[model samples]
Target: MRDGIPRFVPEDNYGKSFGYQWNLHRLTQLDSYVGLPVSRDRLLRESGWTTDELEGREVLECGSGAGRFTEVLCQTGAAVTSFDISNAVEANATSNGRFAGLRLLQASIYDLPLMDESFDYLVCLGVIQHTPDVERAFKTIFRYLRPGGKFCIDVYAAIVAYPHLRQLLRPVTKRIPPGKLYGVVQSITPRLLPVSTRLSAVPWVGDYLTRLVPVANHRHLGLSDTETVRTWSVLDTFDWLSPQFERPQPRRRLERWCRDLRLSEFEIERIRGLYVVRGTK
Candidate 1:
């Protein structure tokens, strides 16, 4: 075990694209750069959690890529056990490792080497849809929650209109090596993002028009500045294209998964096209 966290090595990185991408923009989603703590607010708002509740609590953060959310969790005074399936854990550790109540682990969600019922709360965001099996990933983390403890998660929603272009293009893009694909996106994103920004401004059909293109649309998320939107655009576009598995879950399917896990107090919020679900064990 390293740093008091068990180790489970993966046969190969199923999410190596994420590993490379997060390390590239490790601090983009972080609040420090924007002075807003957007990730923190999203977590608390979606989870219905308060600083008072997080303080002194034991929290497990799954798929904590590059520690963007881990920084927020640390600020809550919660004892955070953060893990990722990539060397992005190195980036997270470099930035937040010195915090008093944080533990780091590098393991896969399919088989985590942690004790059951070991945490007071669990927070997983922006990760489930990327996993090979969303249900199995959900259950694996749910088993780590203490009875009556809350779990917060978010996944890509199955928007029939959204991702239409991504789906069509992924068959070709997924096969390209991660680095080569990133170079391709880097060349195209600058030109396409501005167009998406303007197209998204149109009324009625603007949303659909923007969705027709694969460039990441942070416009709907209220990010307007040229540089900020561009950064998010590059990061998100790479994120959408590079993953080995991409599954957008339907609302009913998510609810059924919660029921299958015997979780209670289940609440779901549709925030900016992402399905955020919170429930209790």
Candidate 2:
């Protein structure tokens, strides 16, 4: 098992509970990236690729935090295997149980316990950078995908963003607890106002009421609803804590990597602040 919080999936033998709020309603709201202009339900529409592209194909998704997209992939006739490092996703498994073809496995990207060349389509989004090593993780995932299979992914690009600016605030921000720190950050950041943030936005109220708060300006810009706000509050804080910008692989660089791995036909779509790289093995 990978070294991390006690909630690490591989170490959790029971899988009875993951002690996190990860329901379908909550997950669909936390995100708006990947397949831009398209919601998670509109995956094929936005990416210009559909599950019909690989009818009845075996699929795999790494870092299936809440299996929101996993549900969509399975609905499209793909056999989907979703994996994550946290037992916290046990709730995700339960929530997604309606999809019989969907499978939830507890594992990490660096040490995926799967038979080589077992999948025809692979997806690892919003992950990789948080791992011990990115290259190693990519190589490991590549081994599981069969030749001619496609891999679609979205990750933080190296481009500079004010969110990264949160790092500078971390010095003072870190002094407080994670929950409280997130709240303070949320208040100053106006984007978090309309919707209520769960973990990150909760503690700020206490601090604000008691006058222990620090700063507030960042707005809750993207997330529209309360559930979306909470999920974003928890996740964005996690991103701020472990921001890893890994992207913009020159087409040649990515092409060579794909070639070495027997993956072909590389294409990249640049979204507002990130990149969605799609290629075939």
Candidate 3:
């Protein structure tokens, strides 16, 4: 298999950009402030993912972005194999150096190189939607999990009432990739709040204007790598500008596909803008 995406050492790139770190730092700050909307820590707490739940189990974390979930899974005592398609792996490797039992690898979701049925628990979060083929990716994940083992994941939701509203913003952000614009907006939008309080009073036009202008200072989680955050954002914007397609399949449609794979669908939840479902494979 190919080596994972090389670590994005922005020291090699950031010198030329303006206000880059501001945008990046602010996004990292946002991460610490809120729980990952994919059921949040509440789901992790309920799933018994605390220390004893993953004890001695073989866990595979697909799309272990920046190692946030990896750190959580690590607390559970499971041996985790962290994987992703981008430089996040290298960032994870660098960020996760102090931790052991972590095997970081980078590769495509549809074509994972590991052997079949290799893990007792497969934790693939925030990844299925970004894949070119969500069905095949699900099938690939199913292959990695042991029989009766669980695979938990959160997918982008199309069924939510505001997607059309969000989708309509595409024209304004048409320069942004439909896939990644949300990531950009989540980070950049919050910083615009000073004027946002004033601007929000306007109609739909207000939000658009707020989004177009870059804020002077952003926030950070302090635990995060400031450089990686900037790189992730710019790349996310680039990714949205050029993507696999416009949007991904809805949650129910993905659920049906999971059914087709003979995977048992056990939990499904509709959060603010995402539909999260986890199952046993």
TM-score of each: 0.94, 0.67, 0.65
Return the top candidate by TM-score: 1
TM-score rank, highest first? 1, 2, 3
- lDDT for model 1 comes to 0.84
> In angstroms, how far off is 196's CA in candidate 2?
15
Candidate 1 error regions (>4 Å): 1-7, 160-163, 221-224
Better of 1 and 2 by lDDT: 1
Scanning candidate 3 in windows of ten residues, the lowest lDDT window is 13-22
Q: Model 2, which residues run further than 4 Å from truth?
A: 1-38, 45-47, 161-163, 170-238, 242-256
> What lDDT is reached at residue 126 by model 2?
65
lDDT at position 145, candidate 3: 87
**Candidate 1 — worst ten consecutive residues by lDDT sum?**
2-11
**CA error at residue 27 for candidate 3, angstroms:** 9.9
Taking all chains together, the TM-score of candidate 1 against the true structure is 0.94
**207 Cα displacement, candidate 3 (Å):** 12
Colliding residue pairs in candidate 1: none
C-alpha positional error of residue 35 in candidate 3 after TM-score superposition, expressed in Å: 12
Candidate 3 on 175-260: residue-level lDDT in tens?
Answer: 54333554665566445434544554568776445344443212222224445444444444433333333445576787687777
The C-alpha local distance difference test score for the whole of candidate 3 amounts to 0.56
